[model samples]
Target: MTAPRASIGALSSAEFLPQRVSLLYRLSGNDVPAILLTSAIAAFALWGYISDKLLAAWLIWLVLASLVRFVLKRAYRLRQPGPEAAARWEGFFCLASAFVGTAWGVTVMLLYPEHGQFHEILLPFLIGSVAMGLPPALAPSPKSFACLIVPIFTPLIGLLFTQGGAFNTSAGILILVFSAVLLALYLSSNRALIETLRFGRENERLLEQVKEAKDRLDLALQAANILIWDWDARRTNVFLGGNWAIILRVGKETSALNLDELAQMVHPDDLPKVKQALDNCLNGGESEYVAEHRVKTLAGGWVWSLSRGRVVERDAGGRALRVTGVNVDIDDRKRAEVELLAAVQREKELSEMKSKFVSTASHEFRTPLATMLSSAELLEHYSESLSPAEKANLLQTIQGGAKRMSEMIDDVLTLGRAESGVLKLNLGPANLRELCSTVVSEFRIAQGKQHVITLDDRFDRPDVIMDERLLRHILNNLLSNAVKYSPPGSEVTFSVSRRNEQAAIEIQDRGIGIPLEDQPRMFESFHRASNVENRPGTGLGLAIVKKAVELHGGEISLTSAVGSGTRFTVMIPLRPVKQPAGVS
Candidate 1:
C-alpha cells in the first residue's frame, strides 16, 4: 500500500486517464453486435404498427451509430494513442456513444405505435434493455456511459407519463426507477475500477524503491571491505554476499558454504575460539557472537578477520532458525597489535638489564673500596710499630686494590660505549702473531709460574689492516679468563690462522668450563657463569671483548662443557690494503 507521495496523487489524477480510455475502447467493441441485433428486433416488431419508412429510417440511424462506434474502437486499437492524447480519444468515444443514444431516443418518439398495445410495450422494453447494459461496458469512463444512457431513457420515460392511463403512468414510473438504478451502477463500477488501478500502480512503485535500496546497501558494504552472511540452521548452509569473494580471497562461484567447509578455512589455532563464540550465542549463553580469527586464503596464507553476528530468527521453542552477520577484514589492525606487544616486551627487558647492572656494579665496587680503606688504615695507624717489610706489604696491598678498581671502571666505560653504538674501529696495519705472542708473554710473566701459556702462529699473513687497541683487548681478556678459570699447572694455547680470506683466532684452555645453560648469555653485560661462585671478577671481560671484535666486522663463537675444557674462536674479515696515490 505504501508508495511515493507523487505517485499516490497521480493515481487518481489525469495520469490514469489514458488507461481508463483504453479500457473503455476495448469493452465497447464487445457490445457492438448486441446493439445492432437489438435495433433490428425492435424495428421488426414495429413493422406492422408504424410506417415502413419511419421504422426503416430509425433502424438505419441506429445501425449507422453502432458502425461509427465500431470504427472508433478500431481506430483506437490501430493508433494506440499514449497518455498525451487520452483526452482526445475519450472525447471521440463519448460523442459516438451520444449519437447512438440519440438514435434510440428517436425510435421512442417516431416509431412508438399509438393503437398497438404490444408494440408500445415492446419498443420501451428494447430501449430499456440497451440502457441497462451500458454500465459495465463504460464503467472505466462514467461520462461516456452518462452520455449514452441519458439520451435514450429521458424521452421514453416522459412519453409514458404524458400518455393518459394508469398503465402508461405505471410504466413511466418503472422506467424512471430502472434508469436511476443503472446510473448508480455505473458510478459504483467506475469507483471500483479506479481503486483497482491505484493499488496496482502503488505495488509497482514499491518494488522499484526496494530494488534501489538493496543496491545502495550492497555498494556501501563493498566499499568498507565488509561481507554479509546469512545462516539457515535447519539447512546447515550459509549464504555469503557483498564482496564476499574479494574479502575472503575466493572465487565468485563460492557463495554458499556449509559449517564444516567454513571451519576448514579457519586457522587451526583459532578454530576452537571461533566455534565457542558461535555456540555460546546459539545456545542463548550470549546475545551475540563476536570473534577475531585468521581465515585461510586461496594463496595458502592466513588473514585476520573479525566476525560479528546475532540470531535473527527463532522457532517457537526458542531455538535459533536463522542467523545474520558480517565479516570485517582486520588483518592490518591485528598486525599492529602484535608489533606493539613486541615493542613493550623489548622495553621491559631493557629495564631489567639496567637494574641488574646497577646491583652488580655496586657489589663489585664495594669490595675493592673496603680493601683500599683497610690497607690505608693499617699503614697510617701502625707506621711506628710495623717493620719495613710489613709496611711494604701494606703499600702493595693498597696499590693492588686501587689497580683492580681502575680496571673495573675502564671495563664499565668500554662496554657502555659499545652498547650505545658509539665505539668505532681505527683500522691500521697490525701483526696478529705478534699481538698474540705479546699477550701470552705478559700472562706468563704474571701467572706463567702457575699455568703454562703457549702461542702457535700458523697464519701466513699476520700483518693485516686492523684496530690495534681492539685486538689487544680481545687477546688480553681471553688469556686472562683462561688463566683465572684453570687450576695451577693447567696448559692454555693461543693459535692464529687464515680461513676463507679472514683471520681466525682460537684460544683453548683446560679450565673448569662454563655451564651449558649460562654459556648462551656469556657475552651479556654483567652476566657471569653460575658456576663462578665467589670468583674475583666483575663479569665485564667477555662482554667488552665481544663488542671490540664486532667493531672489526668479525664473529665470535665458543664450545664449552661444565667439567671439560673450553675453546673460543674469533674470525675477522681482512681489510683490503690501501695503495699509494698513483696505484690502482
Candidate 2:
C-alpha cells in the first residue's frame, strides 16, 4: 500500500520522507517534558557529590531548561499541524533532540569512570536505556532517531574499543555488535511505518478529486435551469440526473417519473410537434432531436422550454437505445417575441386610419369652397345689371358658405386636441339660460325658420361655472344634428335646468333616430349611423360633443326609437373642479 512517488504532490505530501519525519518529531514532543523532569531529579540527587563540579552541572541544567522551552512551543504547534506548521515543528524538535543527545554524550567524559566503578556501569546503563527506547517513538522518521541514538552510544563504545586490556577489548567488541543489531531493527520498523502513511495519503487525494469534478458539473447546469435526461428508448424508460428534482421543481415525487410521464406534461397544442421530433430521432429519420415547446410546471401552469440532444448508443440495426441531452427554460424569450408582434400590428392600424381621415377631410372642404367661389363670381358679374335686392341675396349665400367651411375646420381642430389629452378649458361662471337661447336662435336662422327650437330653463339658480366655448359647441352640434336629420317642420326642444348641483340640458328632436347597432360607436370620429341616408355631414359633430361634455366635467347620453324621436341629455356641474394653474 505504499504511495507511489509519481502521485506524491511535493514535500508537502503526508507520505513523503520529510513529511513522515516531521510527524514523528511532533508525536515524540510530549516525551521531552518527562525526560527533563527525570534528568533534573537525577542530577539534583547527585548534587552533593558533584558540588566540586558545580559549574559543569549548572551549564547542563541551563541547556536542559532551554530544550524544555523549545519542546513545549513545538508541541503546542503540532496540536493542529498544517504543512507549514509540520516543517517548523520538525526544526524545533531536531534542535532539541541534538542538544539532549550532546549533553548525554558529554556525560561519558564529565561523569567519567575515573571517579569509580559505581559511576562507570550506572551512567552507561542510564544513557543506554534512553537510546534503546528511541526506535519506537522515532520509527516514523529513522534519520531523526539516528541523530539522537548515534551521538549518545558512539562515545561509550569507541572508548571501550580503544582501552588496552583483554576484558575491556572484549566488552568493546560486544558493544559494537549490539549497535549493529539495533540499526537493523530501526531500518525494518521505519519501512513499515512509511508504507502505512503512504497508503492513507493516497486515499485522501483520490477523494478530493471526485468532489471537485462533481462541484464543477453542478455549477454548469445551475446557470440556466438545465435538466439532464438519459432515455432508454428500447425499454421505454427514463433516468434523469441527480439534479432533476432541483431543476424541474418536482420535490421528492421525481422517483416514479418516466419518459411517458414527462411527455404528458407537454402542452396539448405543442405535444404533436414534440412527439414528431422525438420519433424522427428514435425511429432513425434523424440523427439528432431538437424542439421548443411548453411544459407543465409544478404549479399547474405551462412554461416554455427548449430540449436538445442526440442518440449516443444504438443496436446493430441502428435502432436507437439511449438518448441523452438537456432541457433548458426559455420562457422569457418567448414572451418578448409575442409582445413585439402586437406592437407592430397596432402601428399598421394607425397608419390606415390616418389615410382614411385625410380622404374624408378633402371631400368635406370642397363643397363649402365651391359654394363661396361661385356666389362671389355671380355678384361680381351681375351687380350692375341687377337690383340691390339681387346683389344682397348673392352676398348672403357667400356668407353662409364661408361659415360652413369655418365650422368644418373648427371641428377638425377640436377633435385633434381632445384625442391628444390637451383640451383647453376657459372656465368661468356662465348664464346657462342665455347660452341655450343663443344656440336655438342660431339654429332657427340657419334652418330658415322651418324647425321650431324651444328652450326651457327650470333651475332655481342661473349662474354656473363652465368652459363657455366647449359648452356652446356641445349644444350647437346636438341642435344642428336634430334639425339636419329631421323633416322641414320638425320641433327641436333644448331644455336647461338644475338637477342637484348640475345644470342638466336635454335636446329632443322628432327625426330619424339612430339605428340599434350604431348607438355604441356614435361618438367615434368619422363614424356615422347606418340610418343616416344621404345626409351631408362630416360625422365629427357628435365626436366633438362627447369630448366637450367630458372636458366640462359632465356626462352625455341619449335614448332614441327609430321613426319616433330622439332625446339627448347632458349634465354639467355648476361649480366644476378648479383647473390647473394658468389654465383658462
Candidate 3:
C-alpha cells in the first residue's frame, strides 16, 4: 500500500571524488575540458617542482581547455543531481566524463612530445577505458576506441616516416609492433567486459519479471474472494485454495479435500447439477463447466456458490486432463434475487386486488345510490298528499340509503390516501370517554333493534390528542361493521382506556368471527373472506379503518376465531387528543 521510494543512490553510485569529477560528469564535449584543466591545476600543485618548463606548458594547455569547456557547458545547459530526474542527468554526466578524459589525453600527447612512447600511449588507453566503462548510449563503444586509436597510432606513424631524432628503421618497426599489440589487447578486453555487462543485465531483467509475476499472483489471490481450484480429471487429483473451507462453513477444516469430501458439502437438491457439470468436463464434451448451486454448511446453513472453469489440458483421447477454476460466494446475491422475485409477485397480486375492488365498488355503490336519489325526488312530489307517518317513513328510507352510499365513497377515498402515502392528520385535544359515547350513540340509532350497544368509558378523560375527522371515520368503520355482522339483539361494546401516553378504543362484536386463514389479510384493501360473502359489504371497510387509525398515529389489530366473537382494537397517541383544562 505504500508508494515505491525513488532510488537516491541511482545518481551517485560512485562516491564523491572532487568538484572536478562532479563537473566532468555534469557537462558535455568541451565543458568537460574545463574540469580537466581544474584537475590538471590540482595535480600540478602537487608536482610543480618537477620542472618549471613542464608546469608552464601544462598551464598553457589548461587555459585552452578551460576556454573550450566553458563554451560547451553553456551550449549543453547541463542539469544537476536529484531523484525526480537522476537517470537522465546522470547519463549525461557519464558522457561528459568520457569527453573530459579524452580531451586530457589529447592535451598530454600534443604538449609532451619528448615523453617516452609508453607514456604517450598510456593517456589514450585511460581515455578509451573511461568511455567504455560508462553507459554505452553516450559516446558509442566503437567510436571511442577508434578515436583513441587514432592518437596512439599517429606517433607510431611519425616514428616510421620522420628522418629526425629517435626514428631509425629498427626503432620504427618496434613502435609499430607495440601499437598493434596494444590495439589487440584493447579489442579483446572490450569484448570481454561487454559480454559480462550483458550477462548481468539479462539476469536483473529476469529477476524483475519473476518478482512482478509473484506480486500479481499474490494480490489476485488475496483480493478476489474466490476459491481457486485445479482438477486433473485423468489423474483424479484436485487442488483448492483461497479459503474454500470458510465459505462452506466447515469449521476451519478446509485442508482435507477430495471428490467425496467436496460432494458432502453440496446440497442434495443441487448435487445432480454439479455432478453433470463435472461429468461433462471429464468426458471432453465441454471446454467449460460452470454452474450456480447451493451447498449445505457444517452449521446447517446454506451457501450459494458460482463455480466456473475451463479445460487446462487435454489427453490423447481429447478428454480433459486438467481444469483450473474458481468458486465464488454468491449467497448475498442469491438472497437479493429471491427478495426481488417475491416483491414482483406481491406487486402483481396487489394490482389484481385493486382492479377487483374498482369493479365491485362500481356495481355495489351504484344501485343503493340510485335508489336513494329516486326516493328523494319522489318524496318531494308526494309531500302534500302524504300522511304524516308516510312522509316520515319515506324520508327515513332516503336518508339511510344516502348515508350508506356516503360511507362507501369514504372507504374508496381512504384507500386512495393509504396508497399515495399522503394521508393528512389534523391533531387537537379531544375527550376519549366523550368520543366513545358519541360513536356508540350514533351506532345505536343506526342499528335499531338488530344490535344492542354499550359504551365503557373507563380511561381518564383528561383528554387525548387525535385528528377528529380521521378518528371519527375509524370508529364509524368498526361500529358499522359490528352492526352489519351481528345477529338480531347481539351485544356490541365500545370501550376506551388510557395507557402511558396513548389512548386505546375497542369495538367488540358477538358475530360470526374471522377464520384463522383470513385474519392475516383482513386489513388489506378489498380483501374479504369466503364465509362473509352474503353480508352486504365492501371489504374496504376494515382496510379504511386501519388506514384512518394509522393516519392519526395509531395501530389497529383484530383477534378472532371461527364461530367465536371478534375484537377490533384501535390505539392512538394521547398527545394528539389531550383536552385543555376547562374544555369539554
Candidate 4:
C-alpha cells in the first residue's frame, strides 16, 4: 500500500494504465515474443479484485504495462524499413491489433470486475480497432472497420454482463448511464480518427503522384536532349538543370551570384550582347528570349549554346520573378551550315566546269565532222579525176574522222542521259549464246588478224530477259576494251552460264588490268584507273555499266590486277520485266 508516484499527466492513474493496455493490444494478434506481461495482468487483476483493493489492481496492471512498453521500446527499435517491407509490416500491425483487442477485452472482464470503469477499456480497444482499420494508410491495401466494430461491440456485451442486476435499481441506472457515455465517446473518437487519417492519406497519395509525374517529365526532357533553366527577372538569379552543366562541361556548384559573376561566365565578346537581350526579355517587350553565346567549360574548352527562354510568371508589379527555358548545343548545326555553304559554292564551280567541257567538246566535234563532210562532198564531185590510191586514202581518212566525231557525240549524249536520269531500257528476251557470238564476231572484224577473239565453249543460256540495245552496248564495251588493251597475240574470250535462276556473262582478256587503289572509284562518273592512261575514254563507260545493271535489278563485278588479265562478270535476272496488257 505505498502510494504510486505522481501520475505523468492529467490522468496520472490512466497515464500508467494506457501502456499496459497498449502492450496487451500489441501482443494479442501478433507473434510478439512470449509476453508474460499480459498474462500477469490477468492474474493480478483477478487476485486484486477478489481482495477488494480496486486501486491496487488497476495500479498493478498499469505498472506491468509501463514495464512492458519500456522493454518493447528498448528491444524493438522503431526504425523505418525500406518502402516495400514497411507496407507489409503495416498489415501485420493491424492484424496484431485485432488479436490484442479481443485479448484485452477478455482480460478486463476477468480482472478488476469491481472497478466498473468501462471507459478504461476504451483506450486499448480504440487503438486495436484503429490498428486493424488503418494499416498501410500510405500503402496499397484496403482499410477494414471490422476490427474496430467487433472490439467495440464486445465491450458493450461485457459491460451488460458485469452490471447484470447485482446492484440496486438506482445504482444499476447510474452504471448503465456511465456505460452509454463511454460508448458514445468511443464512437466519436473513432470517427474523428478515421476522418483525420483519410485526409492525411489522400494528401500523401497526391504528393506521390506529383513526384512521379515530375520524374517522368524530367526523363522525357533528357531524352529530347533539352536543357532546362530558370531565372528571376527582378533578382536575376539563374537556376539550371544538371544537363545545362553537362552541355558546358561545367561543375554545377551552388553559388550566390549577382550580375557580375554571371557575366563573367559568358564569353567576353558575347557578354554585353547577351545582357542586352536578357534585359529586353525582362522588359516585357517579348515573351521569348533567344541568344547564342559561348561559355567557358570546366574542361577548359568553349562551347556554343542556343539559349531560348520565356517569362513563366510575373509579379503584380509587372516584374518577372520566374523565367523558364531550354539551352541547346548547336555547334554541330553551325558546322553543318558552314559545310553546306561551301558545298553550294563548290557546286557553282562544277557548273562552270560543265560549261567549259561543253564548249571544248562542241568545238572538237565540229572540226572533225566538218572535215568529213567537206571531204565527202569534194570527193563526190572530183572522184573521176582523182587517182585510185588518193581517192581510197581520202575515203579512209573521212571515215575515221567521222567515226571519232560520232563517238564523241555519243559520249556527250550518254553523260547527259545518265545525269538527267532519262536513260531508258526496253527489256525483251535475247539469246545469251547469240549475243556473245555477235560480240566476238564484231571484235574479230575490228581487230583483223592482229588478236584472237573467241567465245568459250561454256556459252549456253537459251534466252534471258534484258533490254536488247543495252545488252548490245554492254557486250560491245567489254569486247572493245579487251581488243584495245590486249597485246598483239593475246586472246580475249567470252563465256556465259546460268546459276540459281540468273544468267552470268564473263569477258576475260589478257589486257592491262585495273590497279587496286583505283577500284573503289572505278564506277564513279569521270573516274578512270591509272593504268588506263594510254587508253581513249570518256570515263563514263563503267559508270554507265553499273547504273544500267542496277536499273535492271542486276549487278556487275570486276576482278583485276595490275599486269595480269581482267575478268568482267555481268549477272542479270532471267526475267527483267513483266509486260502490261496487250504487250507481246
The residue pairs that clash in candidate 2, if any, are 425-584, 426-584
TM-score of each: 0.61, 0.57, 0.58, 0.47
* Highest lDDT model number: 1
Range of the 10 consecutive residues with the lowest summed lDDT in candidate 4: 135-144
- The alpha-carbon lDDT assigned to residue 535 of candidate 2 equals 77
lDDT of 3 by residue, 342-413 (tens): 999999988988788778787677777787777777787877888889878777878888787887787787
Better of 1 and 3 by TM-score: 1
| Candidate 3: stretches off by over 4 Å | 1-272, 284-287, 294-307, 316-319, 325-347, 366-392, 576-584
Model 2 lDDT, residue 533, Cα: 81
Q: What does candidate 4 score on TM?
A: 0.47
lDDT of 4 at 540: 63
Model 4 per-residue lDDT tens digits across residues 1-584: 23333332223223223232333334432322223444345445555324344334444434443354345434334543444444344445445435544544555455534445443443343233223323222112112234433553466455646566644334435445644654455445544444555676688899999989878876776566577776775665676663655555666754345567667778899887887888889889877888998877777667777888988888889887887788777766777988999999879766865765666566666777787888898799998998999898888979898788787678668767867889987777777778777778877887899888778746455666788877878888778777777789898878887877777878899888888998887776556678776466656677777777877788899999888888999988787445669979
Q: After superposition, how far is residue 164 of candidate 1 from its true place, in Å?
A: 43
Q: Residue 99's C-alpha lDDT in candidate 1? A: 82
lDDT to native, each model:
0.83, 0.73, 0.66, 0.64
State the RMSD for candidate 1. Answer: 9.9
Cα lDDT of model 1 by residue, 450-560, tens digit: 988888889988479999999999989988898888889989999999999999999999989999999899998778899887877877899999999989989999999
